[model samples]
Target: MDLAIETNNLKKYFGDIHAVDGIDLQIPRGSLFGVLGPHGAGKTTTLRMLSTILHPTSGEAAVLGFDIKKDAREIKKRIGVCPQELVLYPRLSARENIHLIAQMHGMAKKDYKERTDELLGKMNLLDRASSLVKGYSGGMKRRINVLMAVIHEPELLFFDEPTAGLDPQSRRVVWDFIRDFQEKESTIILTTHSMEEADDLSDELIIIDHGKIISQGTPDELKGKLGEGDILEFKIKEMEQRDEIIELAKTLDFVRWGKPVGKHRIVLNALDGLRRVSEIMDVVKVKMEDISVRKNTLEDVFIDLTGRRLRD
Candidate 1:
């Protein structure tokens, strides 16, 4: 298989802190790979090293078949990065900002001009293309940030929290843009705290925490790791009764495991959840505002592995 990225026990340290520790990865060309974790999980550091912006303390990596250490310049030429923090000139118009990046990449004027207009249209910013970035809303700036990174049409793209502050409509637009880009066989490495986004976009993903990959797999495969079971979630009418309901649920023979999901809610892993709803309700003995039965989700898999939500 042709690999776009290959890392062997990659490590990076900042004095006393080990930001990235011995992470091994093999990402194939034309694949959409996701890196997920909570804050301080080293996702950004790994991307920086692979992008040739930072040197690794130890181990080796190859980006687009070029050695990251010795061929840093070659790697940069083929990759685009949309960093976690927005990078846009507030005083520049959206068109100017994107055009400037394309020019720096040495693209032909005709090609970049056409590409810039197309990107602006795709991001729903063509109407505001001439407006200075300082007057744009947060979501608009984020869309422009993404547009600038992709204007050069690099073979590999790194998106760190690309939709961090986007509204639902804007997020959908960006998601469609990324999908269209990948349809052209571009390799994309994405790092995000949004479980739904990762589950939807990734062909395969790695969950990193404490500077190490804790789990890696397709969304379905990771959820399958929890084994066969339906999830029963009950929204309690009274917040004070949640704990008591959970304790009662644990004692039920039909329930495999029971735990609190969020405030006023308790979830149970059990077989035949739909048929056993009455039994579960009888056990909990609490007034529930709502009850839902569903299959395993990526968020569930993450919580199972990390003992916390992705945001935590």
Candidate 2:
């Protein structure tokens, strides 16, 4: 199978801080691959190295078969990167900004004009295409940023939080746009804070923490790693009582595992969790703010592996 990206012991460091420490990856062609990590987990740093914006401290990597070090200019020509921070001209109209990227790629005027209108329509920004981007809302600008990245029609794309500020309706539009883009057999490397986005779009995903990959699999496979069970979430009124409840939860044989999530919520994985809710509640003996039981999700597997929620 042709590979879109390949890496071996990739590393990046800043003084004593090893930002991306010795990692390997293999992403197949045309896959929507996800890179998930909490803040400072080296997701962006790794992307930079792979995109040729940052030189790696060590290791070898290839993007679209071009050596990241030797063929950086060639790699840059074939890839589009939408960074976490918006990169756009405040004075440029949305159409002009996208056209500029197309121009950089040496696209014909007619080709860029037609593609610009099509992309703008898909992002729900065609009506605003003539307007200066500075006047646009955060979400609208975000959508434009995405458009600029893809205007060149690169074979490989890297999106670092493409829908950070979008509303539900607008977010769905971007999701649909990405889905449509992937259908063209383009490879996308995405890093997102939204688990729903990752679960919905990623063909495979890796969860990174402290510059190391802790877990990787399909979203369902990662969730399945937590075993068969339901999740019982108990919201405690008093944050100080979490430890006591965790200890109490350990005594219950029905509970497969238990951990605290967020500020005052304790989550437990248990077999037949719905039926054991009352018994589990009886054992807690705490001031309960609320409680609910639901099936395991990718976030649950993330929490179980990293020992904290994605935001934390």
TM agreement with the true structure for every prediction = 0.89, 0.94
Indicate which candidate wins on lDDT.
2
In model 1, where do residues sit more than 4 Å from their true spots?
Answer: 233-254, 258-266, 284-293
Counting only residues 3 or more apart in sequence or on different chains, how many pairs clash (N, Cα, C under 3 Å) in candidate 2?
0
lDDT of 2 by residue, 62-107 (tens): 9999999999989989999998887899999999999999999889
C-alpha-based local distance difference test score of model 2:
0.89
TM-score of 1: 0.89
**Model 2, residue 299: C-alpha shift (Å):** 1.6
Residue 305 displacement (Å), model 1? 0.9
Deviation from native of the Cα of residue 88 in model 2, angstroms: 1.1
lDDT of 1 by residue, 1-312 (tens): 999999999999999899999999999999999998888899999999999999999999999999998998888889999988889999999999999999988999999999999999988899999999999999999999999889999999999999998899989988998999999899999998788888889999998987899999998888888767888877877777776777788787767777676566667787788899898778777776688899887777776775566675
Candidate 2: segments with Cα more than 4 A from true spot: 237-244, 250-253
What's the true lDDT of residue 255 in model 2? 87
